[model samples]
Target: MIRAWKRFAAYVLISLAILVGMDMARADAGSTVAPAAGPGDAARSWAGHIAALRARA
Candidate 1:
């Protein structure tokens, strides 16, 4: 009774999770969003900040 209900709930939750994941994958597959930054952009940005701090000090 209680155990059977728990098992059923788990299966239902798992099935819903699988369906949601599949839907998300399909949506992302059609996305055209571009990358936010190019290679070395983070490093360049960090170096710029460090240079500014040194100049301030």
Candidate 2:
């Protein structure tokens, strides 16, 4: 009935909000952990490595 549908909608909205929040958190954390610029390619390589590690976790 209408009541059940309303409950279902609320659950879906809450789940979506949680997912978005987690994604935003990950992005924020990654930005903070990013390596700084260097003279050569080493910094870029390290950044990619760190990103890969994060994705795995």
Candidate 3:
């Protein structure tokens, strides 16, 4: 019936939206946007290592 079809369409749209939002969030979660630091920046290097460990956890 038309009502059933509409419900199915709505469910599919909502599922697609959730999938897209999760993908976007995960993509952003994977990396930092900070400018690259030189090798002399020990603090930045340590912070980067911590971030990598946290991401793995």
Q: Tens-digit lDDT track for model 2 on 1-57?
A: 999999999999999997666556546555434345774655665555566557767
Weakest lDDT window of 10 consecutive positions for candidate 2: 26-35
Error of 2 at 36 (Å): 27
* Poorest lDDT segment (10 consecutive residues) of candidate 1: 27-36
> Which consecutive 10 residues in model 3 have the weakest lDDT in total?
26-35
Whichever of 2 and 3 has more TM-score, that candidate is 2
Residue pairs that clash (backbone atoms under 3 angstroms), model 1 = none
Q: Residue by residue across 1-57, what tens digits does model 1's lDDT show?
A: 999999999999999997665445434445333333966865654455455445545
Task: Give the CA lDDT, 0 to 100, for residue 16 in model 3.
Answer: 100
How much lDDT does each candidate structure score? 0.61, 0.66, 0.65
RMSD of candidate 2 to true structure, Å:
9.5
- TM-scores of all candidate predictions against the true structure: 0.53, 0.53, 0.52
Better of 2 and 3 by lDDT: 2
lDDT of 3 at 29: 62
- Superposition TM-score, candidate 3 onto the true structure: 0.52
